[model samples]
Target: MELRHIRYFLAVAREGNFTRAAARIGIGQPPLSQQIRDLENEIGTALFHRVPHGAELTEAGMAFLEVVAQFPDLAERAIRAAQRAGRGEVGSIRVGFTASAAFSPSVPRVFRDFRRSYPGVEMTLEEANSAQLVAGLRDERLDAVFLRQDTIAGDGIRLHVISSEPMVLVLPSGHPAAQREKVALSELRDEALILTPRAVGPTHYDKVVTACRDAGFEPQMGQIAPQLGSVINFVAAELGFSLVPKPMTQLQAKGVAYREIEGEVPIAQLSLAYRSNDISIALRNFVSRTLVAHRQPRIDE
Candidate 1:
């Protein structure tokens, strides 16, 4: 009736003697014989034919033995399944990232390497602004996020720096500065600046502002874009020059040109954020693996 009954029945069938079966199972012979009789009564059929020194199987006994023989293997597989799940080996994780962050090495590189180790985990990536990504993590709608930010808000979210790269200038292709391989931060002092608003990513926006200040002049503020990719589009439209992560250069815009800065380059932190209270085994496994893989190193300007 129970798994133990099935196991005991199989053992007795295999050993052919009550004493031998009980010894194999670490039980007493008398209890084993009584248990077998109890099992037969429950099934409403005799399972064994008692002989001179041992037991033989009845027609019903042979059929039942075959069925019970599979129970051990099945039980083992069930246990193994639970163990694997407990270890967070198989499940789904919903991840969030900024449009530009996807093109960066942090997301694609870390995930590409993570999948190799945890192929059973299904990863779903969504593109959102820093604000939206933060909201998703707070609401528990997203399992994790990769974004560039100066300071992250909310006590419910945890942030980690995955990669660091110096900020560069994205200028209109027709701009005179575009012809220069390197431009000075102070050179942009007189030019209008385009940037993602503080609401979208206060920390990242501040990083640029702080760098410009340290260079001896506050950048002249111009248009405000809601996201980094739009910051690039604004530059391509000749709206204004903008500071961006070096990795942002990978985003192809023929109308735009990327130039390194001559002064102290502000380092952009490519960061990962997730709900502090997230208890998903899949999400936890992903965070654990990624942290082990990505140790931030400051990139040169």
Candidate 2:
């Protein structure tokens, strides 16, 4: 039997008459009676006793009514849950990001805002390299990701650029260059440098190398770190200095001093990446609201 049958049966049981029940349900008496009959037949039991003046519940009807009494509340809860799900307020979002992105306040601010707005939607954050984040997005293992814009490329992935800022050099606090407010790229030629994994994002790594090369000499690469946090930590420990996006400097690393890189090398761009074909209304709304809320500031400004 269909849902209407259960509803008609419940209505008739409550009203104790087919005519009034049908009226309440906006259906005619005959159709309501037929639905009740269908419901009884489907259940292989008679649910009512016919009387001259009105309908009365049978033993089976009494048990059925007790169970069906809960239906109205159950149906209401189910409908509300479905609506919340459709609104993207009651599901889980798997978000991936690089170590540097985690250190940035904007990323955490977005997450806090999202949680406050959709408390029912659980967030699972994964920290990885840009390459791994991109792969997770591509493999459908991640719902979305925050990473450098240069790391995201491919037809199916959509990128919404959130911010771009000038690159800064992180040096040991005791380093001589730390005294300068802005360090020229040429000055780093002979300095030991900490670099991110070249395989993580060849374009970004190349940009760093190329920027140094353009300054008239090749960089003396010292330590290679898999993640930006490690690179910054290494710099704090005086292992080597590294070039990082400005936002990363916000991270409190003892003994690490930040200086602006004085040159025309491209600034780091942060973006939200997700599947272009994603049809989740909640995800779309989250992305749109986040972009509107976190518009990038001009690097010079």
Q: Which residues of candidate 2, in runs, are more than 4 Å off?
A: 18-23, 26-46, 151-154, 263-265, 296-301
Alpha carbon lDDT at 193, candidate 1: 88
Global local distance difference test of model 2? 0.82
Residue pairs in collision within model 2: none
Query: What does candidate 2 score on TM?
Result: 0.84
Give the Cα error of residue 240 in candidate 2, in Å.
3.3
Candidate 1 ranges beyond 4 A from true positions: 14-31, 38-45, 53-69, 216-218, 296-301
- On residues 1-301, what C-alpha lDDT tens digit does candidate 2 reach at each position? 5556668888888889888888999988888788788888889999999787768999999998887877777888999999999888887888898877776688899888998999998889898888888899888999889887655555999887787767888899999989999889888778888988788866567777877888888889999887778888999888888888888887878898999877765577777889988887667767866786786432223
Model 1, span 1-301: residue lDDT tens: 7887887888888989888999999999898888888899999999999998989999999998776778899999999988888988888888898876887766787788778877888888899888888888888788899888745765777787877878888889998878989998887788888988788787788888998899899889999988888999988889899988888899879799999999688888888888877788878778877776675332211
